[model samples]
Target: MTTDASSSFPFCPERWLSKGIWKEREIPAATTATATKKKKKTETKKTTTTTMTTGRALEAFDEGVAAAAAGDERARRRARRALVRACEEEERRIGREEERIERRRDREEAEEEAAAAAADVAVVRAREIAVANREAAVERRKEVVTEREDAVAVEMAALHQEQMAAGGEEQSRGEEE
Candidate 1:
């Protein structure tokens, strides 16, 4: 299929030139018995036969032109078929590229969606952690306030006991006097 065009010539120009075309020799009319008898009686007469080249040359030239046209037509058909096959191959290549591109886009979109989902999950986890930390801080502040109230209550109780003891001692001393 990939052979050179010159290898497929109808007739090689160099070979045709070496072995030139020749016209067929014309045959004389068939002699009857009477014409043969007359020829035997008379002397040998030379018959003139026409060997014209113009008509035969024109015919050969016409034939050569027709053969060349046919060969040209064949060459054109081959070229057209080759072009069509190349176009079909190009179309198939483009189709494959488009399919590959589409698949890549689909994969990229899926990856992007997965990444977005992961980010959303991360944001939710961070918010949950922030809320838990705020709750823990509030609990710690409550515990500190409770401890301060307990300490204040213990101090007031100790002061009340001292005042009651002092009042009892004064009353005893006054009674003895």
Candidate 2:
């Protein structure tokens, strides 16, 4: 005869039992209790799964052992060596990646510095060109002023020569009268 704990409780047993209230009842058969415990254990175990890749090394070692058991000595050695080599290679790859990144950063900085220097040189050259152009313009203006003064002097000299010729003609007429 099975005695239900739910029936033994004085309070509303169904409600209290659902709430995990303990009550006294006849003990279950040893076989049934053991079976229930085993089932619960199995269920809990089934829920767990390994998620870390660090276990891969152990897995590779286990594979190597299995390969040796299968009478493949070369396969076993290869797998074991591969596991070790993979770890070493991963470390080296990380180092090389870091070095490459550093080199790229250095190169970019150098290029930027060169560009800034070139821009500075360009600005200096532009200023020099502007100064030279201004000086040449001033010199051309001076030359123009000199040429205008020379032309005016030549016109005054010509007028003085014409007046002297007219005075000589007037002196000849007075002598004839």
Candidate 3:
């Protein structure tokens, strides 16, 4: 919603500025509005609208004092309603801003939590992978050790068999001699 910087004639000089957003503003000395001006020219009704400066629109009490120029009951009611509307509008705006901030905060918090969870999962996976690699290395070492022991046992057995055959042949030859 928007409002004119200056009120129309008869209410203009009151200089009440009604705005919704809260902020610092500079009230100008006077505000202008276009009003209908009539001129009778030889039985012809000539009408023209001209812009004129009426009153200084004050930055403060814009809603309550807008109708200040009229010291009447209707003007007072209008002013009251204007002030109330302004207040309600401001409240709505503040509420919307707060909701927006809350949503942003919630989104950020969720994202941070998700990131932390992902990091934790990654760390767990890395550890599991490391453990798996270590286990695999251990199995390879066991296989290598078992193969070496088997090979050594076979070599010793063959050497013992050779010695027995040589001893038996020597005894026979000696007996023959």
Candidate 4:
């Protein structure tokens, strides 16, 4: 018996398959066509994704920059509004303080006027009292003078009556002698 080098290793099928060891001589036609279509579709999808990714990255970067600029503008507006509010509040406070001072000044003036009026009334009352005291003293002096005049008139009438009676007695004695 003589054996070739390939037939000596029966477990290995690489030489036997090439020589039509199986019943089917080639792979199925349908299977080959389906595999080719699947490979082409996978390659097309990868190429499209790679080409479009750059455009999408640029659009996203532009949007981020715009958003940052808008935020900065809004922050500036907020700071400006805060400063304006602070100035307005300070002006209102000063106005209120000025009004308060004006009211205090007016009150002080009113009090001073009232005090002056009261002093004037007190002076008038004191003058009236002095005048009344002078009138009362004059009345007392008039009453004393009238009483002395009445006493002197009564004494003069009594002396005249006594002198007339003494003259009548002296005439009667001369006629009897």
Candidate 5:
């Protein structure tokens, strides 16, 4: 059985001219539609972002120009001060955001360290408890051994006394005879 090269290799250029391949194909139309949709969405998003940024910059510049155009020197100075204050406020806001991020990172690291330290402490405590339990077991065993030794010694002493009594009785009987 022979397989057509176009049927076997779908992406090969030779497949485009192959029989029965281009008859029902809508790939070009579909690709164009998809490309147009993607381009439209991206352009819209870009335009919106640009407009917002430009609006903010224009507002800042207008405030600065209005302050510089004040009739009285003191009023102009106040406007200039206000513009400076606005710029400083923006800088401070940016700095605060950066500091907040840094603080969050530091806090996360500290919490992780604390958790590790807590785990270490738990391990140490468990080891200490195990040691304590072992020591108690050893002490109990020693007590049991000492009690057994004392009982044995008492029984031996009693046996020796009984033997001595019997010997004395025998001696007395012989003397009498």
Candidate 6:
């Protein structure tokens, strides 16, 4: 029995239902973030970050199966085990990165809140200072008015004494006439 490469090729995730790394499991929908990673020995050989395609992954899985069918069960189990371990590690790393992102967002919100509170405090302090300045100005105006009234009262007292003296002299002069 010969297997056609095109028929069993893992071109996309949907076609990996029968013979891909994920055996007997339902394929996740397109919205789910699911991807498989393969270890690359040569970094300079590839232009893209993804060194292996689905086709190459499927080929590795098939080779493992063939080795097992040829009486090498250890090789097949090790291959599957390594794949599963790699997937788990990738999941852990992704989780840590997501947690870091969430913490950063929370920190940014806290900083914004602190800045707003500081601004509010500054506004209140400015209003208090303005009110104090206005009260001081009013006190200064009252002092000026009180000083002017005292000066006017002194001038009136001096004019009254002059009038009294003049009136006495005129009365004496009229009695003599």
Candidate with maximal lDDT = 6
Query: What is the per-residue lDDT of model 4 for residues 3-59, given as tens digits with 9 covering 90 to 100?
Result: 332232233243333543322222222222222355456332211122122233223
Candidate 2 lDDT trough over 10 residues, lowest sum = 1-10
- lDDT, model 1, position 22: 27
As a whole number from 0 to 100, the lDDT of residue 40 in candidate 5 is 55
**Which tens-of-lDDT digit does each residue in 26-80 have in candidate 3?**
3343445534455633343334432111111122235434444445557656655
**Model 5 TM-score relative to the real fold:** 0.47
Candidate 3 collision pairs:
15-57, 17-62
Give lDDT tens digits, candidate 2, residues 70-172. Answer: 8677876676675565445544655887999999999999999999999999999999999999999999999998898888888878877788888888999
Cα misplacement distance, residue 149 of candidate 4 (Å): 3.2
Q: Go through the candidates in order and give the C-alpha RMSD of each one to the true structure.
A: 31.1, 25.1, 15.6, 42.5, 23.0, 12.1
lDDT of 4 at 17: 34
Residue pair clashes in candidate 1: none
Please give, for residues 40-76, the per-residue lDDT of candidate 5 as tens digits.
5633221112222223333433444454444445554
Best by TM-score: 3
User: RMSD of model 3, in Å?
Assistant: 15.6
What's the TM-score of each model vs. the native? 0.49, 0.43, 0.61, 0.46, 0.47, 0.57
User: Can you tell me which runs of candidate 5 are displaced by over 4 Å?
Assistant: 1-55, 58-93, 169-177
lDDT of 3 at 155: 90
The stretch of ten residues in a row with the least summed lDDT in candidate 4 is: 44-53
Off by over 4 Å in 6: 1-73
The better candidate by lDDT, 3 or 6, is 6
The Cα local distance difference test for each model comes to: 0.57, 0.59, 0.58, 0.51, 0.56, 0.61
lDDT tens digits by residue: candidate 6, 139-173: 99999999999998888988888888899999999
